[model samples]
Target: MKQLTLAGAIAAVCGTTFSSTAVLAQPSAQAADQSEIMELIVTGSRSPERLDEVTASVTVVDAEALQQDLQLTAELQNILSFRVPGLAPTTNSTSNFGQTLRGRTTLVMIDGVPQSTPLRNGALDVRTIDPAALQRVEVVKGATSIYGNGAAGGIINYITRQAGEDAFNVSLTQQVGMNAEETDDTASFRSSATIDGTVERFSYVFNATVDDNGVQRDAEGDIIGQALYGLSGVRTQSLFAKLGYQIDDDKSLSFTANYYDAEQVDRLIDVTSSINDGTKTYAVKPAPGQTFPGEPQGVDGNSNFVLQYRDAQLLSNTSLTVDAYTQEIENVFFYSTTFADPAAGFSGGNSVIVSEKEGLRLNLESVFDLSGVEATFIYGADVLNDVTSQPLADVRSWVPEMDMSNEALYLQSKFVIDDWVLKAGVRDESVDIDVPDYTTLRMCGANNVCRGGNPVEGGKLSYSDTTYNAGVRYNFSTAFSPFVSYSQGFDVSDLGLLLRAASVPDLDQVQTEASVIDHYELGVAGRYRALNYEFAIYESESELGTATVENPPGSGLYVPVRAPQEIEGWELALGLTVNESLELGTTYTYVEGQDPDTGAYIDARKIAPPKFTAWADYTVGNGLSASLQWMKVMNRNRFAPVDPVTGRYTGAEAPVEGYDVFNLSALYSRDNWRVSLGFENLFNEAYFPARAQAFTYAGYNTMGLGRTVKAGLTVEF
Candidate 1:
């Protein structure tokens, strides 16, 4: 019997080295909720077994169903893409913190901390986290013996919120909502506290959150002009803290800190246009910029910060975990320019770009069962440092600054038998690019004066790679299970803006770095008693990630790649419990991408069509509860990109034909106070051309806001 279950986990870690109640009962001695949590421990089995015997494919989100769906909004990737299922949520014109699942690139954490911030240019935005400070949201779809190498698209843990066995507890909440053209009016407030008993034994968990967001328009309420959405009344403020120490229990320690300051200001659109009679010279308004002398005219700021440390052990049956972290970010960009027609003349100038970043990470994990042939292991290291500076107005002939750095080391493993479960991992990363050295002078025509060039100093550019993953799993009972996996990921390129636009001349051994995908995935899942399910199918091929790429130097001469991409996908999820007051959930996703060089296909990767996402709730007896949600995105054929000199198609087309959005929520709790009311896009679905892009100078297609109404109220103690 698997060596008598590894000898009862080595007699419960040798009774936790002479028992302290066997180390506070050894993390619930295995199973407790979420249908017995599918017997999984040792995140990729560095030792503790039973995640259906491991073969990889995990996704558990249930902290009382995410605190009853956060009563309405806590974002978190729009509540895990409407209740997780092959995750998906991208393209509302890109970069809303970016979240992609089956399509790859996934890895978010909290508790096991580390919210990626390699100098702020990759993976982030678990919808600015706030599942009311989380208590659960596992998800391990793919890649891991235990996260090594940016988890190559899979693994999201946010299990915060602890301290229960209650001795002292409190909670409070507030809310208000209005949408369906009420103009995105909403409000929120929260409070929580929990303190268990015992002072000589030790146990504690503390959490905090404060959120406020409002400003969304579309369904004719205006604003939604796309391209990262002109900022919009963006506002955000967050703070999180965790402290744990249990000395007499075979070892344990935790200290976590989270700080996020979100800022938004998107209401600036002017993409070239001029006319004062002479027949209006062809429409297209807003274009007359050139200001940034002292800054202050529609500001900009992006921030990030995190700190964590975890140490755990259980010698007897084998289990150990260790992690260290440090992350920081500060990115600021401001723009406004003028230089189109000064009476048949022009002279450009106006800019402000500043970037700052710092990052460090270290990991180690192990799960044991040697002779019995069940193992799990992971090792890691990461580093990043980035800085950039630019402040200009009108024009200066000097450019060549930005220091970049990156480093990595990784290893992963997994193994199990009986019903089959096996997995593997490998990673090797490196990148270092630093630039400095500049000199330039220009002035031609009407006074000739252009000097020779060759000054621009500071050198150092490096690249390294090696990433891998493998998987397999099978189990025909306990609700059903099936899986398969293969993974690979890489990214690095922006060498100080591609060596200042390769203006030729021994451009240092021309090797603009390159690396892209060749991914494939397949899956299945199970759950019974009130039902639950999951599904997946995927294919990826890339000549380079991000398609074609180009949109760095002076946001003009545009082109965000679009000639080599092939994506195919599928996803579905469901949950039901229709009795004792009702509870239901649903999810669906479909993706398609193509271009393979010109077969054409890029309406923002088809805006994740194949829709249908559902949610239902009922619990009316004293404390009240009500919920409803629906979303459908399915309208293919949206293509617009083909004007290599008059081939016409000039942007915005392809099939923006899919749309459906609805939301309704209500709740009222008694004890610690809670009140929620939500109503989003409920019959005001007006999402114009989903993902529009075509030399965008802000000429439309950033739609998808329409109706929004939210409310909140929370208090716990």
Candidate 2:
């Protein structure tokens, strides 16, 4: 059987041959109305290809879906939890703890620019950018080495908005909402404005947004604490701009800059009672000090700058692109008196971590015709430097400055013949890290318990690896396309954490080895009549699985644990358009992992229980639309019970109960104006998410939000 190229697959599915340029240039929201079968170009892939053409399992969330009344949220995690089947549930907090993709850490990017700080794993990358500034999100589900290190699980690329063909376009949106149970200080406000246009051979886009949230409340109408790094009572602002100039029909240059800032206002301290009998309760009161009960606790800042040049016709059949970028990030944690260590020069103060990165990327794509076969060749190289460090608010070093440099070269080729498509790629990656010796900080105070740090050794380390992938996909028919693929990825251990806790006298004596993960997958996707569906099963394995574990027992310090492990999972999604005004959809996901040697669920921290989501959308006459969504999480009993006092798991394992929630949204549009209303937790159910029940001691047991109402309006000109 002959396989079809992605373009041919799209033509088969849609019964039309779409212009690649036209499809790629159209906005996702507008494109959705033009075709029943989505044919958006995949951005995560180095080469131009449609979603169905690739042999990997991929999902695309378009602009319309992102702006849906029920899907809009300040936190990106919440949006992904419901849309991406394999992704773990959101923690409902500012921090994205335990939120893994395919049961592994995922690499996040913006327009092909890396956003993850792999050296520290701060888990803050997802919130670095506001969703309002993005036009679409592309998710590549599986291990891939084409983009270099840190993509062991997959990659998420956020494509920013672009200038329209109009001479000038302006848009403004405003939203205001409050907790239905307690409307006092629980109100929130958000607003965004954008201006974009294309004039002659130049194009430009600029957007700005601001948001302020009041205290969050549970079903009981109690103020939610700042525990678990909650997002309540926070203020955020963002600015984004892009400018492009066309030198000719085949050549262009562009520049982009973005900035984001967020800070938590501490209005009340968390006085939540400890977990008892597998249950925990939360309460809040004014702080003892004169400082605002909601003084700033967590402060985050992110800035990015990029310059790019592209030539679509560098030669007769070749194209080239070059990009240079720089990124700066700063994260500050809340001040803590209870956890303060006087010995560590801490008198109830906070800590801050900063990371800076600069990189240059180059790529050349070429097409060739061999006899009757067509092939596309993509080759690229990357060079990057990153420096990261952690320091106390008082200017004392916690983690010494670490400098890292990475260099990589990769090539990928896609072949098409008849209705068959085949792809193969390989990457060579090299990394170097340098650390300077410094005295460890004293962490214990006279009255407080402290975890001591390791003092000796500073040296340099180097690592290199070659990873590859291959896949085959057969079109068969647009209604029944199936594919299989195998790929590998490599990840270096969190060097900053390892170096900070190093006790060895010499850096060379330390055991630091990169872990290589292998992924295998089989999937099929199709569209028949008014229905579209996809199903996939995959297995990922690593001889040495990496996990963070408490070290020195009771020291309150953590170190990485490596063991043989394997993870397997499956995902399914189905959508049906009953008519022009009605649509229905559902998604199911299940995953499990274990350590072979220990015979234990080693990925308990990352794995999510089986989940099912269903939704219905109905459009009424007079430009009104309504939607209802339901999500149910199944029970999971993987970990043994834990002693509350010792914070250690007991021998007895107990099952974590399941829960369900419902949401409703309505939108009305007329002329150039749109109004929307959304109700979350429509039933006002008082249930705990899986994370809260499983990790009770970690403050994950915080009660879910009660019924909340959001209303917004948008104007376009």
Candidate 3:
């Protein structure tokens, strides 16, 4: 649909301009593209293909690197952990909880519609939307049933903003920030606007964003609390619109709508700490002027609607695409005592996840040549209807109202022959759930002990599967080009975190079935002229186990254990242009998972350790630019807080002992005004965020986010 159109459709769809999309990934060989130049992915084959014809491993974070991640942070989980690279890291709260990507469980989307509530996975689906209404982001690393069900660690979509050629126009942006050490009541503000154009065949775009944050502080500056999901005094708003028409000339039609809201009205609280005496947690205020309790958590009223249609032939070589969507969300959590119930008069409680979804997608693509290879085919059909529930703002019923229905059918194929590339796919899922027998109350966690009320005995739960995939590639030239892959995924992930901790009296003894992930990958990429590179290694298995266990000790409540995991990882990306205004890059990721039967180390609450990103970019031309970035999250010390025969503390094992962060950005424009600046934790060191050194709960140890400064201004009319 219509959105970005700053003059000739931004050089015919983003060849660059609009003050150059806001720099950062500018220059520096663009890291993965290194310099061979050719990038385009419609989430790895929903359409707009390229990237040397896919065989997996795609990153793409453009839109001037999401405007250099809003100059420092606007929290899209810190803009996908500063431009995606194995993700994980970013529990700087509003609930991305343990942000994972390669570590598993990632299936977020915007344009492709689906914002993960995965049947009560209240981790707030990566803050729903609002990187000022995005225009770029696409990750597709592994595991996939090709957009159906939760992608077992892969897929991050989000691609909005379009239509630039201005038959009409308007744009504006503003920013204000705080807490460089002190800034009065903390200060924060943001504003964004965009109106777009094109007429005749019709095209349009609209976006609105507003943020209001304050109270952050960390690198010893104190206050950074809101309990395990804190950030302080939040307030976010976003709205988006798009429309398009062209229906003649092969066809087209589009419509999109989005809405988001965030909450957390902080007056501050939670000043408790005790990593068993190592101390940490903090966030102040509520004592001198009292006030902090109940209600007021995050996300509510999130929405998305989409309608699309495209044809380009419909037959005669075939081509078609259609989509219809409807979504809804309402996550809210953060009342603490984890959910106490001192007998039932309740001392604490907080829960709310009320998902809703209705979907349909159908696609078709075809080409010919078969015998000589050149073939292509992509077939699809999908339908979904979800309705979740989790109740408890006192309305009780921990996770009842199930009701799901899914259906899928898929087929994909591609072949080229000459330079080689072959791929295959298959899918055939069928799911149907329907509960309603409720009764599992009597809470109390965080060690307050209180067990469950049980009564379980829900009904109907069926899942069927037939996943498969295959891949191969070889362009062979410029040193390397290899590729290999295998994929499958079909999960019913957070069954409301195991039906509200059911004490199982029947739900079929609650093992809940449904999980079939299996992924394997291997890779190689090339370029020597300016050095481009990519390397991959992966393994992912699942006989069950997707992890989630936190029995008795420090119970921030978690449940679901089937054991039998096997995760593995590897990644490396390097880019170097060294000329053309300077560029250089680096990336590294290493993941580890265990427990194929007591091999241990499978819980850091879902594995993460060793990550790195390095960057450098420079341009001296008249409209100046600058960039620098470095991040690290090394060290790992799996287990041993006290478990020598279960003496407590297995709270997802602890000891991450890692930290490093640095950032800086700059930009300047010579016309119509555009100016920017950034610096986020750019050397204020004082660490602690690897989920506050590996999660043992207790407000997640806190700390991380000091040194801040952002400045921005933009105008266009």
**Candidate 3, after superposition: displacement of residue 41 in Å?**
16
Per-residue error for 161 in candidate 2, Å, reads 0.4
- Please estimate how well model 1 matches the true structure, expressed as its whole-model Cα lDDT: 0.50
Best-fitting candidate, scored by lDDT: 3
Better of 1 and 3 by lDDT: 3
Steric overlap count per candidate: 45, 16, 8
Which sequence of candidate numbers ranks them by lDDT, best first?
A: 3, 2, 1
Angstrom error of the Cα, residue 674, model 2: value is: 0.3
Local accuracy of candidate 3 as per-residue lDDT tens digits, 343-435: 667787778888888999998989899788888888889898898898877788778989999989898787888877777778898999999
lDDT of 3 at 560: 76
lDDT of 2 by residue, 1-717 (tens): 112232244334423111111111111222223234446555545656766565466667777778883334667777777777787776677776677888888888888888887887777777778888898777777778877777877887888898999989998999988999888788899999999999999999999999887787887787665755777888889999999999999999999998988888645666654343455556476646645411264547788999999999999999999999999988776665533656544565565678899999999999999998898888999999989887666676767887989999998878887767777778899998888877555566445655545666787888899987776777777577776677778888766666566666777765578888877776776667776777777778788775666555334355667786678888888777789888888888888888867778854467778888888888897989888888888888777545556554521123457888888889999999999999888888887766666664534467788888889999999
**Candidate 3 residue pairs in backbone clash:** 3-162, 4-162, 4-163, 4-164, 5-164, 5-165, 9-164, 28-583
Worst 10 residues of 3 by lDDT: 15-24
Candidate 2 lDDT (Cα, 0 to 1): 0.73
- Predicted structure 2, TM vs. truth: 0.92
The prediction achieving the highest TM-score against the true structure is 2
